[model samples]
Target: MSDTLRIVLIVASVLCLLFMLRKISQSKVRIDDAIFWIVGAFVLVIISIFPQIPSWCCDLLGIQTPVNFLFLFMIFILLVKLFYMTIRVSQLESKVKELSQRYALDHMDDEVKQDEK
Candidate 1:
């Protein structure tokens, strides 16, 4: 990769890391989610600084080019993250449904008791 591109990537990664930290400080992002983003940003910065690392990795994995390897790696990471988020959302939805049902039942019982009185 060109030096200019590497510098840009490094700057962007640093900015993202800073943004994530700010969000965490403001309680806008959960620690668990922030951890993944923070780590991703760090990895990007490291990769940008040491472009040879990706080339080495590609060679080790028998990949043709560093860029292709990076694309594949990023896609894999995103897919894993998406899967985790899907599971979390599903669990949250189930909990919300259960809570709403319980609340409705309690409300109905209260109304029935008032009517009886």
Candidate 2:
């Protein structure tokens, strides 16, 4: 990897890490969610520090270049995170639907009791 790319990676990773930390401090992002970003930044920093790692990975994966490998790696990680988020959102929606139904039942029972009284 070129020094320019290395420097850019390190800078970007540090910025990302810092941004996530700031978000966590502001209560804008949950720790679990920020964890993915934090880990991603760490990986970026690692690759920046150890160019050989990406080179070896590119060779093993038959990728044309380290830049291509980096892009692919990042895209894959983000896609996995997106998939997890989709599942999580679905689970939350299910729970909300269940709770809404339960609440409606309880409300109906209260109205019926008042009517009988």
TM-score of each: 0.91, 0.89
lDDT of 2 by residue, 34-69 (tens): 888888889889999999999999999999999999
Candidate 1 TM-score to native: 0.91
lDDT of 1 at 104: 100
Question: For each predicted model, how many residue pairs clash, with residues at least 3 apart or on different chains?
Answer: 0, 0
How does model 2 score by TM-score? 0.89
- Tell me how candidate 2 scores on lDDT: 0.93
Best by lDDT: 2
Off by over 4 Å in 1: none
Each prediction's Cα lDDT score? 0.91, 0.93
Model 1 Cα lDDT, one tens digit per residue, 1-85: 6788788888998999899989989999999889898899899889988999999999999999888888988999999999999
Query: What's the alpha carbon RMSD for model 2?
Result: 1.4
Q: List the residue pairs that clash in candidate 1.
A: none
